[model samples]
Target: MTRKVDYLFLRKGSQNWHLKLQYPGDLGQKIGRKRIEKSLGTPDRAQAEILALPYIQEHKMHLLHGHKDFRIVWKHRFEPGRQHVGPAGERIIATDRELIYLDPQGVITKRAPNGDHFIPVPPLLEQKAAVRREQLRRRGVRNSDDSIIDTYLKHANVTGYNEREARAVWSLYKELTNGKPLREATREDGRKIVQYFEDNGLKSATIQKKVGWLNAAINLAIGETKLSFNPFSAIVPKRTDSERRLPLSEADMKLVRAGMEQLDRRDQLLLRFLATTGARLSEAFEIESELMERGCRYVIIGRKTPQSHRRVPLPAAVLPFLPRQIDGQQFQGTARSASKRLNRFLDDIGITDPRKVIHSLRHRAQDRLRAAGCPIDYRWALLGHEEKTVAEGYGLGFPVPALKRWIDKIGF
Candidate 1:
């Protein structure tokens, strides 16, 4: 079977996917419909999931407003173009461009300017839906755990949803419930889910994060109803597992420098770049060499933090490793490989704790700042960290010259 994403569902026999959504309010009474489902063509489960999401959304609009215009838009949206697999797994290519339409009497039409024909959707195609306003505004009081998840994800669709986090939540929820009604779900169910994660050898802190997201989702879905309780209310994910890798000792730093010498010129400079400037491995790998300059005191970090995109002063150790200017990226190869190479060197130098990875250099840089009497606020700002204090967010919290001195102290 194919992977399901929200409203997208895969057909067991046909191997095709569909979207299913619940219609809202008394609007269903007017249309003899309480739900909507649409076939998202393709035996390829991945593409169907992609196409179904937007279709479910449009279908939701039709369900809510029940307008002929919306129906018309939905009907012709999937123009029979290009190629798709036939019902029996045969290769079916569009002979010509054709559009599917739905007439008022629930008839489906396939219109081609070349040859005119209208075909109704087969009974098997009647399968999927996507709910609109996954926003808690409408789905809040809905009873299902799925409703809570839907609402939370819909909200995240705007700000941003961490893909890893979303996957973790679904993996746990999928194993825990068969769309159990959220209001009926209890604290015990939540605890059971956490235990499931632990049984699978997941870390306590990671499971805690997943629980946190579920807790937030349940809170969002608790509208004006008889139920005022959240199932995930009692999930405690302590921060004991947090990674706070300290700076490498001065002796260890020298060992790392020596290890860099063992690498080729490109990787040598790249590791040095990360070590001294605290740039991410990917950032060092993506530097458009044209951006670098000779004798420049400061350089802008990559786009990972746009708000903190101000120039940061470079330490002297990193300066010797620079080339006058090249075309792009100091290093070659994938970021993963680069990290593996760095780790191998760490292992060689007798430093191989799971927590003390390549990023510990960045931590050490911060320690360098503190040892040099740099303020905590300035230390983070220099590292292009999201300034923790509101004061940092307000304005140019620290002037360039002052910040320059702190970064200058981050030397080998």
Candidate 2:
């Protein structure tokens, strides 16, 4: 005869709980309960215990009837109501059971029974549900593991970023992915990534640009991929005003001239040419006598723009300072070294603002031309700049004498 018994399934290796049952078969076989465990996408031992209850009750009845087959026992006990068996024959009895599975913290997930499937309420969702739940429970929330990170990298193709700039963005994204849930990422997290670069000695401008690109990637994840949110929108960098135009004052110009006087003849000529022609430091360094002799009155400023390589009329004031034969050889020093030397010279002459070095002379020339009411088009041309209007309209061939007249007015 089959005897029904109420049995509680404590997970395998679980202690402090026992399944009580009565059966007609051998007492040893019916009394000694086997451990029942279930895998339900959770790590909590309590969840395993709770999920095994119905299976345990069914198994105990089968054992009492001298039945040793688990598959048949499961089919009779838990399989009638459910379509799927839990991992190890422990069937989920109540899919909608309000049983709370607590992590180390008091965080709890209420497992509710769906039509044919058991749905687990994730911790994050539980938090939202708790606000409306009559009873509140606390539980530990586990961050997304490294698996999520692997997923991000796999889809992002981060390894394919070949440019240094693109690679830098990917590196920062990788750093942010450390055990963080894709949904938990915030704009503050993006700010910290930008700050990491700044604190590590990257320039502020570069940090700003890199952070912007990182935000773009985060947006991509949110909009194009499966990520739930973009966390970069909240970061606000500290703003500092920058001065691109560093025109030298009259006193600063005098100091610079005095400093040039102290340099050797060739170096002095280079300095004078830079000051008078307003040529970029690199363009001045690359000047050749033959190029200058071909009526190339102006040296192009190639570093900033393609149009920057246009000719400005040769400033006659600069003629006195030109080398008899232009040193066909380019200047040997790097831009940084040249800037440092120029700064040292300025410092010696009591110019406190180091910005008044070589480039400041270019600013000063532009200022002088503007102050004299020189046409904006002419000034732009002299500076090798594209005009705001049609490019061809701006006189490509500036009259040498007219340019000289403007230079004479400046009286450098």
Candidate 3:
């Protein structure tokens, strides 16, 4: 006698077992089929039952998730028959009887002719099936352990300090969200991030900047990811007044000037140049001596900002202090090291305020220009401040000679 197996049927002439399963009424319309069938491609019933488990699980998940294409190999097959209801309220008119059915708890059970049934899955196999179900359910869903920050950085081609800052902020975001995928990050997570910064004593402006970077990055990647909108977009902390660099007093200025001669020639020249012209420390370091040797009275300040990209006129007082000729970059070390050295010099000269660093000299230059009765346009142009009014943006700005006239009023 041939043994009967759940979810497996043998045709009249063939000894090979075939798999068949009936879809519940609701799922049949969605999958566009009332039943699913496929060849197990084996003569042995044991091998066929083993192969049938995947199909059975796939059908269960497909019905559970309402996915139409859970298993590609099993195609839909419908056969004509008169409708009849079985004892358990299952349709009995299908071409093949479904011996396997999902119980109330969703466990697969084998149904016998005498109304007896038992779950076919052992505990170990059931655990693995649960994992497989999760994998199938999450297909095409992003956030399943993928690094969204790395993907965004790769696509955006972010590099340098910007890349480093974004990565740093992203790391913090992960920590705040308990290392959740950035795509899975929610508005609540953004709130938590802001709260974290505030609790750590970060100023509102700094918190805003860090959050803004994260917001802008996610905004750029919204089109590629499944996220509807950036969670950090409206979560920015309120803006607050930023710290200002204190301008040097006349006595402070005089002290710096008198102390310049006590330093090395390079230090004296760097200090005098910044004090007179109000050029940024980085911009000053970028001034190639070769460009000045060609008799260019102005130095280009391109690396800072579009407004700072203007040519700053060399003040007449500092002209005697400039190197006549040198190869490559004018300053030896990086701009950061140069600022540290200049700040130390200020501290040594008794101008020791936290805000009275090397950058304060730039503020002093504007004050000096204002004292000399330089017009507002000339002051804005000389200090590389962005044009505020429509009229200010109209011209090529004050001529180099015109800028030199006002800048000359300030002495080292």
Residue-wise lDDT of candidate 2 within 174-260, one digit each (tens)? 455553554776767667776777678776666766666555555666675557777666464665734455788888777766666
What are the Cα lDDT values of the candidates?
A: 0.63, 0.56, 0.71
For model 2 the local lDDT of residue 404 reads: 59
Strongest candidate by TM-score: 3
Candidate 1's C-alpha lDDT?
0.63
Quick one: how many clashes does candidate 2 have? Answer: 9
lDDT of 3 by residue, 1-412 (tens): 8666677988778888888899878889877899978788899988888889977886776665654322222221323244444468554333332334344564645543322222334478766877666644443243443455667677777666557667667666665676666556688888888898888988788888778777866776777665666778888656664667898988998898788866787877788888898888878877774333234477766455556666677888877866665345666677777888889888888998877889998888888888889898777787776544555456567667777788898777
Q: What does candidate 1's lDDT look like per residue over 124-208, in tens digits? A: 3232222222322232333334545666777656233344465456545555665466667778777888888778877787777
Q: Tell me the spans in candidate 1 whose CA falls farther than 4 Å from its real position.
A: 1-151, 157-161, 200-203, 223-229, 237-244, 261-270, 279-311, 314-316, 319-341, 353-355, 384-387
Stronger candidate by lDDT (1 vs 2):
1
Worst lDDT run of 10 residues, candidate 1, spans 127-136
What lDDT, from 0 to 1, does candidate 2 have? 0.56
Q: Give the RMSD in angstroms, all C-alphas superposed, for model 1.
A: 16.5
Return whichever of 2 and 3 wins on TM-score: 3
